[model samples]
Target: MSRVKTAGALNKYLHLPLVLTAVFILINAGVYLLNTRAGILVSGGLVIYIILILVIYGRQRENMLNDLVTFATQYGQVQRKLMMDLALPYAITDDRGKLLWFNDAFAELTGKDRKSFRKSIASIFNGMSPDKFPARDQEIEYETVYNRRDYRIQIKSVVLDDLIDNSQILERDDQEESSMLYAFLLFDETELNNYIQKYEDETMVCGMIYMDNYDEAMESVDEVRRSLLTALVDRKINKYFQDLDGIVKKFDKDKYLIAMRTRTLNELKGLRFNILDDVKTVNIGNDMAVTLSIGIGANNGSYNRNFECARMAIDLALGRGGDQVVLRDGDSITYFGGKSQAVEKSTRVKARVKAHALQEFIEASEKVVIMGHKMMDIDAFGSAIGIYRASRTLNKRAYIVVDSPTITTKPFIDEFENNPDYDSKMLLDVHEAKEMVDDKTLLVVVDTNKPDYTECEELLHRTGTIVVLDHHRQGNNYIRNAVLSYIEPYASSACEMVAEILQYFAEGVKLKSIEADALYAGIMIDTDNFMSKTGVRTFEACAYLRRGGADVTRVRKMFRENVDDYRAKGETLSNAEMYRDHFIISVCPSGNLESPTIVGSQAANQLLNIKGVKASFVLTEYKNVIYISARAIDEVNVQIIMERMGGGGHLNMAGAQLPKVSVEEAVRRLKRVLDATIEGGDLE
Candidate 1:
């Protein structure tokens, strides 16, 4: 290649010298051919002209060569000086990832002296070398060895044939082959990141603090000490925010608004917002403890936006039973502490008020349609029946929407179906109900507030006037357009809430024997036969039902398990295994069982009897959908665990459904979720 390139250069510049030589030869030959004095004289003059032309051309060529040499020398010196004096950390690497050369800044940044720089770039830079460059330039953040500071790195490709080290590579090669090289330039970004972190630390975060059960707490104290108790609560709250440099103001009787810096807020988060525990320790002579519901909003667009988020968060915290901290960053929410059970309200004034409003709505509607969640359990069905009775009490036509009932609810439904006084047309299937619904019909949703979980979501959409009555905590997807919503997370069950509402009905309006028994059964099943979540109002509602002639014996017989279901439960318990030290997990074997979910719940309850177990989970697959029943005994919040898997229930007992997964896969996913909850400090 070098010889061919030399011949081409000679051919390009040979024209000037060859033309001069040819002209001289032609003049000499013409003079000799003339053979005369005149021709000889002319030839002599041409010789001088040729000599002058040759000398001028030679001098011009020499000067051009000298100028080229000078420019090359100067360019080489300037390039060398730039490499040595450049402020940015710079380095060059060959195709093999070996470091060919580096500037002083790079050596200093990497904490390597010239003597110690004889290593590969990857080895020196902690293995960040790129084998090939991307088509476009890329900027990356790198950490240096000097002080572990961050650097913004830029790399560009430098072909060997065009690089300053081309001669060195060519000299070392026997069969010359051009290779690829890279030029790296790095700028320190440590200070920039520090500035960003400082801004984050100083950012303002908004929050709201609610004194849950404030009126009840104050009422429990002596009349003379009530002011003192309020002062004490204020002192605790003020002192809590004193060190945080936060501004706190009491906006209402039970609510306080606060503004705090994100640095202190993060510290509070790390400590799990111990204010909830701290306030509980304050003693004002009240038998019941006072708790707090704190909601924080961070990383939002504006202060007002964050404040709005905080307000929504506090509502959610209180709806989920209070004694918790909820942090809302835009659409995502993270919960901190919610260990205490909800305190049942001391008065039913709200229930009475809501009942009156519902009566007014029902009085104006043409007809009423009541519905519950799918797989209607006793609490769901009983709540539906209670609402239906309430509509009848108002002297309006009503219907109960029922679909494929589960085994647990089949007997209770059968009693109603067999009753003579009950209207056979009152029970409507989802399809018929959808057809019957109109703009004037009142849709009262019971047991569950989520539209997705309703028996007839299509009918729900068609109905104009709707009322929501539920005991579960308000979730993200609640029915938003209800004219009236009565959701009390503190209630024992939906039936218990509806039963309370039934008491406030007009005079001479009453519950039938079967309706009373069904409502009582709903209360019993949800409270685990009054063994869990039963409050004062729970028993009061049951007493009212008994007064209405609710036969306990009949309700008990309705809950009796058939032989096949009993066998399924026993088989499920046989496969129980302990996990996470003390929690039991059992996957029910696939079979044509009548009620797999009932068996799963029964099996979960029985697993709690094991000596050291604190929680139990039963997995059962029916028609390719894996159903899980999670139960805990004062040691875990299985509700949150199930909520993470798209299900929700009470704190100690919850269930989840996993679609299109086998029993083994469901168990594996359950374990992984348990692991994450435990690792994330939400569970023990």
Candidate 2:
């Protein structure tokens, strides 16, 4: 091979010299035709000239090759020297992620001295592997945090032929084989991130603070000392925000507008917004303590949008019965300090006004379609039935949207089935209801304000006239186009809210015995037989139902479960497991059970009776969805817990539905949520 390489190297240099020698030889041959001795001498001279030229050209080729090889070696060394001293963190790794070479900046970033260590780059940076990189164009870029510093990593791939073609470290024989290597450049971004965070912290945030129950609280005190109480409460509020570097302007006697930096908002969240309780501590011989509803908005991308979000958040906070803070950050809405029970209002003015609005909507609409939640429970169906009766009385064609109700609601449905007093097709399926809806149709959503939880979400979009009446605390997903939304989180049951609305719906509105039983059963079941959340208005609503001929004994008989359901409830209690030393977790038997969720709720209530138990959860696996029923006496706010799990309800009574999970997996998820809640200091 050496001999062949030498010959090949000398071949180009010899070509021109040999051609000139060949011409001299040809001239000698032509002269030989004239004189033999002269031609012979010329031929000899030509041969000598050819030998001299080949020898000289071969030596010249060797010298030139030596110079070229030396230059290539020096060039490779210079390139490597430049990379080694570069300020930017640079590294070269093989396809297997083994570091071949690295610059000084890379050594500094990795906190390692220059050495011959061929360690895997994975040890320095986690989740980085050549196998995970994109194949096309052989380039990748991403951001990562290392050693408490942010870095933007960029890596480019190169073949051995291009990257180290003239490298002196490898021989020409070794370069015949092809290999791949990665060049990485890391940019430190810690200071950039800090500056960005500072900019974000300085962004303006706005809020609305309203004195909840201001008139009611003022009336409870004497007219003489009311001014003092108001002043003290105002001072408490103003001082609370002023200490946090915030601006407060009292726009009304009971309302204030606030603006502050986002950093202050974060500090407020960390403190859990104690202002809700601070305002209540201002006691100067007043019979009632004042409560406040604070709503703050941030990250809406515009100042005006932040104010709009503040308005929306304040409305949501008030709708959840006040005494809370709702933070609307972009699309996320967070609740803080809602652990207190909602204060019940003694006056029914809002209910009367809402009833008049409902009367107007129903009377003017061409058709009315009442929608309850899917898998309707007693509260949902009863509230829906109440609205149906109201629509019927208004002389409009009304239909109740009922799709696959639970077994608990089957009894009421059977009563109205094929009856002469009701329309044959009064109860509509989801498909049938969608076809009946139009722009002029009135869509009244009862029991649930969440659009996804409604009987038919498509119907809500099909009609422009939509009214929402729910007793559940509003969560992330709700009807956005509600013409008139009447939500009272303090109410024991949605049926109770509807029952109150029905009284003021018309001059003389009456109910049939069955209808009254349905509504009464709803209140009975939701309030755990008037033993859980019953108040003055709760009992008054029941008394009103009694005056409407609702028989308690008959309603109790209607709620009777089958033998299988009775056994399932017993099984749920038997399988109950204690968690975190206070919460009880149980699973209701869902095998061949139609009303598993109702039985689960009943079982949850039953578990709460255990001594030292703060709350109870019953999970039932039905049709590939885990239905979780949570119940609390007062210590635990299950509404917030359930809401964090993508569900919402009253503080004491909340439920959630998780699809495509096993009963055991559902329990594990519940445990994870409980663990996170405890870590977040939201629970005991």
Candidate 3:
């Protein structure tokens, strides 16, 4: 087929030259046939014509060759463009891995133009070597950056063996090949990976809700009553979620699953779920209240992980005795509710065990230094003093660290200051406290176990020998390095723990009247004069204090506030607002005269006075910090709510500090978390 085409092309060329020659010959013959003079002129004209024909034939051949070159150039350009349009970065390289050709897409993907690309592929790719690349039909995936854009690139190499073989077909077997060629295809996956990462992040927040006491709520009810209850729950839920965008589905008769976008989560954070107090008031035939337990998972990096976290939070709420809201974010867990009643627990064994452990810890240290939470109250002061007395009995040098100016209990501070035996030199500031702390120094943390709330966080960290005694519910931040930990949430106050430990050490030895009074004052302050949250152990501890010469009248006098302070407390209580059936919220801006502790407690107590109120919370400003106090009347769990704000206490009472946040901002954040708890949403 090739030979036939070549012959035809050659024949066409020969025909053109032959026609020119024939025309010239014919002109010369005509000139000879004419007269002599005319013949000579005609001959010269024929010769000129021959020269013209030859020149034209040569020009035609040159044009054909130019056209062929032009066609080849256009064809190569079209092939390069076609490869680029295929969505892959394409490049041509010689056997030595040197780039010989590349299209616009290749340059764009590599952030290098054709000139730079030809110089060296490794110039753009750091640490890349030609020898490391795989052969034809094999591909490798690697990460690279181009023009500040991160990408996962796929590199492939191909050998032009067929082209090379054809070119060298006539060459000797021993002849060395001059060059080899390879084609590379690079695909950008940066945007795709980013999209996948976004999806993973969104999926991780999960929400869960469980119906507390479902069986109890349904007991004694017929099928018709059960259906009515279910319908009512569904209607309330649908209505509550009308404004929020999320998928709400009934997982079971007593469970629900909800999926929401992150934007929806942020929006839901503002709705105080405490407003759903009416949900617990669902009236059936027996007038029984039905409450829901909600768990929200936050901090999961993926949707499935968040879902699992939400499930775990719900389980924790149920395990701790339901009818509450549980939120777990990372390592921290917060709870709300459990105020209606506390599950009865016996702590006799725990107390005895803790007592033995405390003795062992005391024996191990060179000396014991007792401290309390910042802004020391009577409970903190009493607890520290009790621990100091215990250390004295052991013949160990002891110190009670206190910042008196920051003390909330002015009378208690003054009384300690006036004591003849009190050593002023031993009282250390945070920096001096660090110098005093050592491996041999037994640092006993009283009243609170939270590091941020401690009077001396540096002392806690510096001392290897440590002990913690508190009455607050266990939180994630509870001291972990304590040689001994005696935490009893059921106890009324830290003073109770100190008194109990002192009894174990003294064995009926009488406490001084002042010491006894200070201890009694702590119990009274925490228990609201034994009107709320007084358990059997609390009263027993109080009775012991009374026997030890605690003057009831004197203790009452210590609690008496100045007329201005009293008026401030009364004003704060007057601002309380009742929301839902169970909760009351009040904002108390007590100015400079009122301590946050005083204002928060005053508002909490006043909220309890309202008819049908089960729980009360107060937001108060003191200095630059916003303080929060939560109180409940055996029907609400206030500790969990306070814990969410980085505070922990008993089921009935808890307090927290919000640094650098305005009282209004703290209240707004608190309401959002409360709303999610009351309602149901993803926790993680």
Q: Of the candidates shown, which would achieve the greatest TM-score relative to the real structure? A: 2
Clash pairs (backbone) in predicted model 1: none
Q: Which tens-of-lDDT digit does each residue in 367-452 have in candidate 2?
A: 99988998988889898888988888888999998897988899999999857898999999998998999999999999999998
lDDT for predicted candidate 3 compared with the true structure: 0.71
Ranking by lDDT: 2, 1, 3
State the C-alpha lDDT per candidate. Answer: 0.83, 0.88, 0.71
Candidate 3: residue 425 Cα off by (Å): 4.3
List all candidate RMSDs to the true structure: 6.5, 5.6, 18.3
Provide TM-scores for the models.
Answer: 0.80, 0.87, 0.57
RMSD of 3: 18.3
- Which portions of model 1 miss their true places by more than 4 Å? 1-85, 90-103, 113-146, 153-185, 363-369, 392-401, 416-442, 456-466, 475-483, 505-509, 672-681
Q: Rank the candidates by TM-score, best first.
A: 2, 1, 3
Q: Write the per-residue lDDT of candidate 1 for residues 198-286, one digit (tens) a residue.
A: 99989899999999888889888888988888788888998889777888999887789999998988888888898898888888688
